[model samples]
Target: MNKLLVLICSGALLSACAGTNIVSLESSVKQLKDLRDHDRDGVIEAREKCDNTVLGASIDNYGCGTRKTLIEPLKVDVKFAHNSYEIPSSAYSQIQRLADFLNKNAELQVLIEGHTSKVGSVELNQRLSKNRAKAVENVLVENFNIATERVSSVGYGFERLADPADTEVAHSTNRRIMAELSHTVSVDDMIWTIYTVDQTQ
Candidate 1:
């Protein structure tokens, strides 16, 4: 009887040890999985604060994207001849600079404002101002390869003058083209290669 009781107790101990081993194995597997980087974002799952990050995007130590909000401003100075809507060759350099800025910020839009002096009749000045604005817009679209939808032009005929005085300097200053490009955008803090999957095939 004593031998029989001892054999039963030993069997029970063996079953208990098997259960412990199974639990231990499961725990080890869980730990290894937590240490893996499923997203391949340089951070392990155990330490990752963000999940499913975009492939090849710049990320912090916690696997979160590092993006910055920036406000960029651009100014263009173009002078137009009296009673003329032609864009001067001298202003090409200024327009090129504006073009470069727009190309850098592909999502940005520009507003071109054309102004005229009060020497001509209001009707003539209005038409001339509008034509001058359109001239600049055309140069930007045709010569600089800027998108038509990204640029807009408006003419203010002697209404919003830089100098209200009826002097030669004031008139010259008033007859000009003004452009401003400003926008807020989120940009990656660091350069990274973008990965894309082609499905067209």
Candidate 2:
């Protein structure tokens, strides 16, 4: 009876401690909300805070900081012709812009995602998508001289369609590549990776 009583008391204490943490988190979120909503618009814009800061640097729950290092991710999409992994010369500008951003932010890592329209065989689409991603990756590494280790590529095939219509325009829209920038952010001593757009001008 004595041991059972002791175990029950310990469980209650642990539960109470968890409850305290929940309340603290709620309070902190509220405080951040109040501080960030400066224009009374009830929405916190990225320009209002250190939302453009760098990766691995210390930041608050709302991304405000005493000193921010990294900016947000800059999205640059490169389009492709149907059933082809060969990057068009027209898409070179987008790739160049991405290279410039990567060069400026050395600590930032990039993920180049390849996608295809739903007009080819599944296996063929998969291979083509991977190749498309690789093509972009090569441009950054070989042409721009960005480190290979800093960039990685993935192929999603036609599984994810940007447009579901059965029209040429829609298919053209689906046949493209997506570049996403991400970094790790810490909150309450816990670290998590977050993807945010670069709002800096």
Tens-digit lDDT track of model 1 for 49-89? 99987766788889997888998777887888778888889
Error of 2 at 114 (Å): 0.4
Instruction: Please give each candidate's TM-score.
Output: 0.59, 0.56
Write one digit per residue (lDDT tens) for candidate 2, span 33-144.
3346544333365445545544444456556543424435578788898888999999899899888878876888888999999887999999999999999999889999
| Each model's total of backbone clashes | 0, 4
Q: Listing every candidate in turn, what is its Cα RMSD in Å to the true structure after a full C-alpha superposition?
A: 10.6, 21.4
lDDT of 1: 0.81
lDDT of each: 0.81, 0.74
* Candidate 1 weakest ten by summed lDDT: 1-10
Clashes of 1: 0
lDDT, residue 79, model 2? 87
Q: Which is the leading candidate under TM-score?
A: 1
